[model samples]
Target chain A: MQIDWFTFGAQIVNFLILIGLLKRFLYGPILDAMDRRQASIRDRIAEAESKQEEAEQEAEKYRSLQSAFEAHRAERMQAVEEDAEARRHELLARAREDVEYLEAQWREAIERDRADFLHTVSERAVTETIQLTRRVLDDLADVDLEDQLVTVFLGHLQNPEDALAKKLIDAFEDADAEVTIRSAYELSDDQRERLLEVLEKRAGHSLTLSTVTDRELGLGVEVQVANRTVGWTIDQYIEQLLDEMLRQLEADLDQRLTADVSATGSMASVRHR
Target chain B: MEISPDQIVYWEWRFVTVNATLVYSWVVIVLLGAGAWFITRNLTVGPDISRWQNGLEVLVGQILTQIETTGLRHPKRYLPFIGTLFIFIVTCNILAVVPGYVAPTASVTTPIALAMCVFVAVPVYGIMNRGLKAYFKRYIRPTPLMLPFTIIGEISRTVALGIRLFGNMMSGNLIVAILLSLAPLLFPVAMQAFGLLIGVIQAYVFAVLALVYIASGARAHQNNGEPAPGDAEPSSAV
Candidate 1:
């Protein structure tokens, strides 16, 4: 076997050229692509890590804001509850005051109604009693009763007390003074003359007497001289008895009303408690 | 039968001649260069790559790994020279299975030329990595008196590298030829299959040896503080 220098030289040249060709086409581009891919992968990883970090930070910020918001909401809720509680208490107080005012007005109206009813009852009772008494006396009255009332009036005139004699003398000093005799029934002429004579003797001067029939006198006689009146009549006794009865009835009604009011006040106080 | 493709002259001039070795070398070169250009024309930086690009990457990656395995720290700097050697040699050997195709590595001249390239690249890389003085100083390492032996060892190893590849490739082809004449069918086919395996192995051996030699040269001075070339494991079993 022989070695060919020319072929050897050419092969060496061919191998060198092949090296250059492979380096340019294969090694250079492939290696560069791999390097670029590696660099890109590294950069992508770094960018992903950075984004993750940023996301974590943002999440933390949001968490903090949420925490603050929760705290603020809790605080506001507490304040609102407190305010609502205060408002409720204020409204309750106003309602209580309104109830108290309405109760007081109701009690006052009840008392006023009671007073009006009592006054109406008292007036009616007094009027009815007086009317009944007057009717009874009128039914019972006759000439005798009238004569008796006149006799009683004459007796009071004839037997006058010291104070009555003075008041009678002073009243007769008026020369123009006249005596008016009023009776529930008509007086006879004899009875009128007697009544006049008795009044004249009591006065120690001659008196001018005038007789009148007054049905409201109720079997009684009254003698009026000037502005003084001196007579004994059933009307006086009846008036005194009516006045005592009215006073007793009024006292009874007042005591009953006071007891009722006290009872109502005690009940109202229990309800308030 | 011609034992080497160099014997098959296609054309001859006074001092220059075109032979089968030259012709087939050109064919391998063109096929590799065209294939590389075609596959790498649209290389993507993404994970999705074409099958041909994948194949080329595997081939180039294997070469880079082998270079690195030779204790060369920076394997990329020597990728062009060493990677091309592996690609050209392996391609020539693997293509031997095809009909009427002669492996250029079977010729003594081609392996010698390849070994010469490695021989020249060793000192070039050595000087480039270390200074020129520091690189040449490795020749007389341990003593100046051993300089001639060291020089002889360097030359002898280079020759041995060339001869080792040439002998293996040539012997396999010669055995296939001799077996074809005696038992042309089964033995020749089986021997050809064996030859195919031997061819690929020889290519790998040749490239790995070249890488180790270059690495040794480049890191010769630096090996003083690190693992010397002798102490480092061989790149391949061969």
Candidate 2:
């Protein structure tokens, strides 16, 4: 084997040229591309991390806002429930007051009706009793009721008690004191003279007297001296009887009302059960 | 048969001549340069890349990795020299499988030329990495009296580098030719196949030895005036 100097030198030069060419075409471009790719990947990773951090922050912000909104909702709901409860109580109280007022008005109307009925019945009974008594005296005793009333009044004057005598004397001592006599019917002159004589004898003085026919007296006479009066009248007896009757009627109505109230209370308790 | 491509001259003009070795070397160079230019012309810096670009990248990357593993701190600084040595030799050896194609590496003149390039590059890279004074200081390391022996060691290893590649490639070709004449079929084909494997291995061996010489020279100052690991025995059995 032999080596040629010219071939050796030419091959060396060729290898050197190949080295330069390969470097320019291969190593330089490939390495640069790889380095650039690596840098780009690194930048992308950093950007992704930053975006993740921002996303987490945003999520946290939204979470807090949601919690605040939930708390506010609960508070508002509580306030609304309280307002509703208060309104319900107010409405119930107003309804109860209205019921009580209406019940009172109804009871008052019933009481007024009962009182009017009792008054009408009492007036009719008194008029009937007085008429019946007048008819009985005229039919049985053959004496007029007015004459009897006058007789009774004269007796009360003639036989006056010690206190009555003193009152009459004191009344007669007033010189300007005039006597007014009211009767159911017009008195005969003889009856008036007799009443005057009796009164004057009891009083031990002379008296000025005025007679007035008042039909409301109902066969009774009244002698009034100033503001004082002395009389015996059927109207007074009838009034006493009507008052007793009214007391009895009121007692009955009160008892009935109490029973009705008790019954209503028992029914209300049953419904509650 | 002629042992070297230098004997097959196509033209001559006194000392200047055109021979098979020069022609085939140019052919390998053109093929490598054109292929590199074509594949890397439209190279992308993105994750997506062409298959050809991928293959080229793998090749250049492996060469860089090999240089780095040879104790060179900056592998890229030695990539062009060491990478070209491997590619050119491997391509020439691989093309020997083609009919009537004599490998340029089978020529004593081509291997001697490549060895001389490595010889020159070792000092150049060493001086560039560690100053000239520090680079030359490695010859007299351990003692100044070892200078002549270190010089002889350097020269002999360069000679060994060239002769090792030339002997292996030439013997494989010679054996294949002799086997073709004797058995003429199966043995020649098998030996040719075996020669292909040997060719690739010789390429690797040559490149690695070259990287070792360059690395030892560059790091001589860093090893505290002692020679680097491969400085004592830079030759490869392959």
Candidate 1, what DockQ?
0.71
Per-residue lDDT of A216-259 in model 2, one digit per residue for the tens? Answer: 55557888888777777665766687677767766766676666
Model 2: how many Å of interface RMSD?
A: 0.9
TM-score of chain B of 1: 0.94
lDDT of 1 by residue, A33-101 (tens): 777888989999999999999999999999999999999999999999999999998898778766865
> Residue A115 of candidate 1: its Cα lDDT?
74
DockQ of model 2, rounded to 2 decimals: 0.64
For TM-score, the strongest prediction is 1
Candidate 1: deviation at residue A226, Å?
Answer: 14
Per-candidate DockQ vs. reference: 0.71, 0.64
True contacts kept of each: 0.89, 0.88
